[model samples]
Target: MRNCWFATPGIARPMSIRCWSSRWRRMPMASDRKLTAFFLGFAARHKWRFLLSVLAMPIYAYLVAEAPNVMRRAIDDGIMAGDRAATIRHSLVYLGCMVGGALGLVAQHWFMQSGGIRTLTHMREAVMRHILGLGRAEYDKRPLGVYVSRSTSDVEAIGETMTAGLTNLIADTLLIVFIFVNMVAIDRKLGLMTLVIVPVVVVVVDIFRRILRPLYDRIRTVNGTLTSQINEVLGMHGVIRSFHLQGAFNRLFREDNDEYRDTNIKAVSYDAAVFSILEGLSFVAIGGVLLYIAVRATGTEKALQLGAVVAFIQWLQMLFPPLKQMGARFAILQSALAAVSKLETVMQIPLPVDEGTKSPENLNLTVRDLTFAYNKEQPVLKNVALEVPAGKSLAVVGPTGSGKSTLIRLIVRQFDLNPGGGEILLGGTDLREILREDLRKKIVLIPQEPSIFEETVRYNISLDRPEVTMERIESICRKIRAHDFIQHLPHGYDTVIAGEGANLSMGQRQLIAMARALATDAQILIFDEATANIDTETERLIQEALDYVMATRTTILIAHRLSTIRDADQILVLNHGEIMERGTHDALMTRPGLYRRMYELQRHAIPDQ
Candidate 1:
């Protein structure tokens, strides 16, 4: 029955949501749908406030619309008819209407502005939370500059413009409609004449919208580039200065700045042209109305009253600006929509890995015939098969890009392997069925680069497990040669490792990372050349500590320096993502292979082992 339900008519097959890098072509409406849903749902919740804003919009227009009517009546029955009582009574009504309209206009501005500000705050926070929700795996796929752009500029654009658009669109549209209706009611032929500029205004604005949208997108692209460049220069300030490239870098910075300026200037120039054209047409239409009124006034029997002419001019002045503002609002909407679409596209990309349903305690991992590739034609790791015997060590060795690090990642399931690529045996079961969180707790891998937050050393090592005792922390630190460094610090473990532990040496940082992994106390452990960047003395110290810490623990070691793996129970040589050779050190030396060659070359780098 369940299968039948899934197979029913009009139901789509549950295709795997492929990773962005994996797909050859882009997905359809992927980002547009997500962005539309988020924005629409948000607006829907404030529907009542929105309607209030909408209703308030035309209040100002109502005043302008009523202006001409009041003038017509004051002329026909009060002023021109030569009756003092009628003139005074009608004059008072006109004064009252002006005062009330002015006050309502002020109130209208207050509510629209308040609502825009309030909604923007909510949207900014939502974008921030969504970013924080992603795991380390998801973050690694995106560029640092792109992420920065999304948070600072992109969210701000989406939030501010969307709310501003909602407000102005409501108000401007209402004002224009009310004015058009009144103009037609008073004099249908003249009202029709007034709209001649509208089609021209709309056409000019449509061109402006199309041209300006791409510019905003380009501006954002350049913004990401500028951010990335700044980050790279700042991150590698030491290297840049050492290489004496300050002058060269400054030139590059100037070039980027100039490009950004040129792009913005061009967009502004074109938009200015659009405004100029619209403004000129508005003046022409009003001039025509004034000329026609003047000619008709000289010979007309009800020669237009003095007050009536003044109020008609005010109504004309009031009408054109809101029309102009409507165009500007449309421009903002176009630009903001472009940014939202880009941001939404990235967010819609499915996370490559998902957590397993089984409990962590009951889970283990298995890998058999495992193969994967960044590109389909050439596998980064191919037909690689291995096992982590329960409570033992398996060391992997090879040159760079030979799939050593990729092996560790695969064990953690950071990337998907082909269905028949291989099987990872966890205890007695295949890893495919194990619960992900549970599996992670059972086996944890530490990498070459040590990750530290701007936090205390104790917090870095302890992670989220608050139950770890100080004694256990001290033991791990001592074993990794990190205890001495901690003691040397001004506040010991309490000292804050700000700037991601920039104060610590590379060796000390790696030791701290090892301590973090040790704190987990998982059944299986994998170390990926953690000692590569440290000096020989520090490497030896850590190696000694690792021997003690790794005793009887199921471990996978990826070593670049052959000396570290001398005591490894089993060593596997991976070449081009395939296991080319495998055996103990003495056994592998007896055979002529990739492992033997690498061993001979590294003997100078790993003496007395």
Candidate 2:
């Protein structure tokens, strides 16, 4: 199969050695460098273009600053001075500057937006790879929707900051500076007087930030929670409808929706107040500047020129909007930062550490004192141990909560072994010493709930592996007795499977899974109740297929049906995480132990078997 780093969400395989390499190790956490260094890395890849885009901002700002100055000259040196030709020339120059500024915007957006898209795409892929690389134990810690939000909405939030928010913020800051410089050049007294409001504007922005930061963070959190709840409910759609839980789910969604609404209202109220204050301050600065001009008119110094006064008013008009938008821009920044804070937590989740390089030559499986627990106080598997010799089959029969599935998971290294816990070995080398990719090539696990993608039957079976040809797939399917049913489908092997195989029966999914596993030609095979919840006729066909497949492979079978493992070389009865009995099936049945008792109970419960 063509192993993909970006695998289907439900389909998983062992990770490659590259997953542990320095490529991912170099990613900086938000707490360590606060996303500055991280985002800079993306820009660094296209450094020249990013730099040029930023340079365009200052040029655009300069043009904007010069436009009003051009107007000032046209009014004073042309109109007031009765020079119509000079006025027309200055007016034409103003038009050229505006046009140049417009072109600068287009160029800036093209460069900046392209880089932003590249950054967002890389971010999404990294987040998904990291999430997929996480141990099964880590998956147990959060909902699927949280990861979805991190990769989709949260990443887009950061992208918005990069493309729309950050670029404009830089332009606005530069324009503000240039406008203030022009104000001073026009008249130092009035310019310094206008500067008096700088401290006040800074104070207002600071307070607004202090109030809105937490609100933005809270909104993001609530939004993620609501998304999670919706996903959870949707996944349980069948169960919800069967149980008539519409009203209950409605109430839950309503509560979250109300909370989201309330939080947004609070943010908007404060945002509106801050924005209005900035607008009011701009007019106040203009009023204060006019008052200064009036007072100075009575002085001995030359009277303020009508053109300069008009230009000063125009500068305020240009200046205050960017300042007012500064708050809205900061709001976008806060949203992005909130997203960064959330995604950083995800990135910080340590990937499963594997430093193994060894490859096994034999498939001998061994376990000594194997123990595990999801909770510290509650051990799921106590000091249990077993072995399956090369080319031998070991059947494990146990009731629910007997650690049967956990044992299978441990064999595949789904969850990391606990410290001081027992170890597993293959070919006399510790299982941990084998590279995960190499180990995956040696083993095939068929779980009860097989993951079926929305792809053709052939693709599902071969997984696009170059070696698993069409002839081989058909041969394997025929051996497993899946070909008969598959051929009856709309397009035979080419028929597309629905999501989770809803179009196929449980038996057919298992058959396809068996075909997939056989195509791998793995040395070690594990069946974790693969035949459970299937029809008797289908179960019999699977057993026949298993009989053929298990002949030359090291096999471990966990079964609730005692009859399925009757011909196994050995059987182990496990209870409460401990093996209660171990022997050949006939030998176990001959005794009055847990194995014999369970076998008898199943024999009577399902009499046909």
Candidate 3:
């Protein structure tokens, strides 16, 4: 089979057929291709508006070009000849051209802005949808703030480029073209003399672009890093303070902040230097035009007419502002291109492949020769095999890093197993053959550290499920013995929990997590050290709740405390990724194996409850 690969910013590897498979791969750096492809695709979606914008540009250019000609006629045929009527007629024509040019400009701006906005909106929506579709494993690999930066600042830059930068760029290019055409139309020799500055300006702008591209890339990278650091610090503020590492975090943040500031300064300095050079070049071009006009007027028998000279000067003036402003416009273009590259890189991440068509009808669980490794070299679960009948509780006990949590992760498809390593079955159907959503609905894992959103208790319990009514929620809470404490809260089910349930005690958070699990009404429940973090008092409160929740469902409990698993239907002792012993409470005690030894050690380590 062909290996599947997805790319993010740093890592690159073929996606393995595991539960936590990557869908994205690194896209090659093809800035030009990415930019051109995006605009072309955007234009196809808004064809009429884009075409209309293009059409208005030449018309606007023509109207603008007509103004200088009318002025030349008024000065030569009317004013110099002492004919007021001719002057008035030419002046009226100039006014009419100016008005028409102004209207055309409005139309151009409207069409371009409209098309750009629509295109960017669609792009933003598509990026957001892709981000949402990414698996938990992707989020685990990248900082939340990096993704936020991509969605906000980076996206805004691209939008600005498409709308304002693009509009002005097109308008200026057309204006320059028409101005050059008219300058030559009036006096070919003089126009050619003036056009000599065009190449000089083009070369300068090109030099600036080459110098600034890498600087802007640096700015964007630093900004993203700074944002990521800030987000991480804020998210873990509690831990940082508890450990008294505030000073360390401050130093780290200061370094990142300073780096961001310095990069931006460098980019701005380059922009300023380019702007100053272009402005100086503009003046030089104007002076050269004047020198040419002075020589032609003084040395020739039939001197250049005053009217033609003035009109040509006006055209020359119009030409240089666009060239002068080109540096700033190019800066925007570069930033936007960088944003596009980033967006394309993210969009290439592959979504999870959900090809399973089977759904389990019962909750009987079986694991056969299940082996896994994070690095493929050192196996974590080595040929593990176990079975749990429907509605039976299985307790898994092991020392730390002995594949206890790894086994649970494999069953939940957190990471994919190697082909031929093993197979897991639910209700006699292969686990890989069951749809993810269907599998999740049937089995729920209440982790040791449950995530509680900053929302009402009701919302957290229901998890936005519209069908989970208040009565059902309260009933579940009551069964889990969480209702009394919830009722004592300020708003009962409506009470809003703080971030990660910081306002609630450890036991309260675990109880809420239990309530959530029970709310799902899943057929199988896996408790991965759910009561490990709480105090003895909290564990007592939770044990009552756990007994009721595990009574009907098939349960998988991972516990260090032997007391917690005393009533378990079966206990499997694991050590170094292999099953060391297996039996019930009495049978395991008689064996004098890993389980019996562990039980005796814990019993002696602490007094019985």
For each candidate, what is the lDDT?
A: 0.69, 0.81, 0.79
Quote the RMSD, in angstroms, for model 2.
8.7
TM-scores, each model vs. reference: 0.78, 0.84, 0.84
Q: What is the lDDT of residue 550 in candidate 1?
A: 61
**Cα distance off (Å), candidate 2, residue 59:** 1.6
TM-score for model 1? Answer: 0.78
Q: Which stretch of 10 consecutive residues in model 2 shows the poorest summed lDDT?
A: 17-26
Give the alpha carbon lDDT tens digit for every residue of 1-609 in model 1.
Answer: 011111112212221111101111123344566667766655666656556666666775576467666766677677778777777777777776677666665556556556655655666566566676665567777787677777677666655454555555665677678777877776666678777767766776667656765675676567668987999899999999999999998999889889888986776677578667766766776787788778777864345556545555655666666565565555456556666666665566554455456543332344578787755777888878776567667888887899888777767766555656666666665565667777778778777877889988898999768777788999878876789889999999988997867898777787888788888857787888977887787788778767865694677888878878888888888877788898899999999988888878777655754
Model 2, range 1-609, lDDT digits (tens) per residue?
Answer: 112121212213222212111111122334546666666665577777677789898888888787888888889999999999999999999898888877777777768888888888888888899998998878888998799989998898788777876887788799899999998998887887777776787778678767866776677678778987989898999999999999999998899889988987887787678767877887887887788788889988777888898889988877765664565555566667667767878988999888889998688899999889977888889888888889999999888999999988989988768888989999988888999988888898999998998999999999999999999999999887899999999999999999889999998998899899989979888999977888788889888888877785788888878888888998988999998999998898789999888878878888787
The candidates, ranked best first by TM-score, are 3, 2, 1
Worst 10 residues of 1 by lDDT: 15-24
Candidate 2 local Cα displacement, residue 144, angstroms: 3.5
Poorest stretch of ten by lDDT in candidate 3: 16-25
